[model samples]
Target: MTPHELETILTEIGLSNSALARHVNRSEGNVRQWRKGVSKIPDDVAEWLREYHYFFQKNPPPQRKG
Candidate 1:
């Protein structure tokens, strides 16, 4: 996926760079690079995002009890 598309997915999933980095097993700086177009989105990361989008659509996560 393109950087713009990744950014859109991140927004849709309500995750910031820090959260997405953790989910994808990457560093926040890496996510920032992808978001800013300083580096391309890795193929695996794109696929993970796609899968996450699909899964989240089908099964939204439960809210945290605070």
Candidate 2:
């Protein structure tokens, strides 16, 4: 996905760059670079985010969905 799209997803998930970095095991600088458009997200990272989006949409955490 595009950087903006990723950013939107991050926002929807209520995570900052640091939180997302922790979730994905990436560096905070990498997340910041992606957000700043200074770097592109790797395919694996994109896939991870897509999976997360799907999981949450289809089977969100009980508290969040409920």
Candidate 3:
């Protein structure tokens, strides 16, 4: 995905760059580079984020039945 798309997804998930970096096991500066479009986000990293998005969307938390 493009940097803008990646940034948008992260924002939608309420994840900061530092958080993403920690999850992806990369340095915060690496995330910043991706956000700034200095370098492409690696395929593995992108896949990791996509998987997280899919998991959350597919299996949402159970709701209280009031």
Stretches of candidate 1 exceeding 4 Å from the true structure: 61-66
Worst 10 residues of 3 by lDDT: 53-62
Model 2 lDDT-worst window of ten: 57-66
Q: lDDT for each of the candidates? A: 0.90, 0.86, 0.89
Model 1 quality (TM-score): 0.83
Off by over 4 Å in 3: 60-66
lDDT of 3 by residue, 1-66 (tens): 789989888976778989999999999999999999999999999998888878877886687998
Clashing residue pairs in candidate 2 (N, C-alpha, C atoms within 3 angstroms) = none
Answer with 2 or 3, whichever has the higher lDDT: 3
Tens-digit lDDT track of model 2 for 1-66: 788989888877678888889988999999999988899999898998988877777876667553
Q: After superposition, which runs of candidate 2 have C-alpha atoms over 4 Å from their true positions?
A: 63-66
Candidate 1 lDDT at 64 equals 96
Q: How far is 42's C-alpha from truth in model 3 (Å)?
A: 0.5
What is the descending TM-score order?
Answer: 1, 3, 2
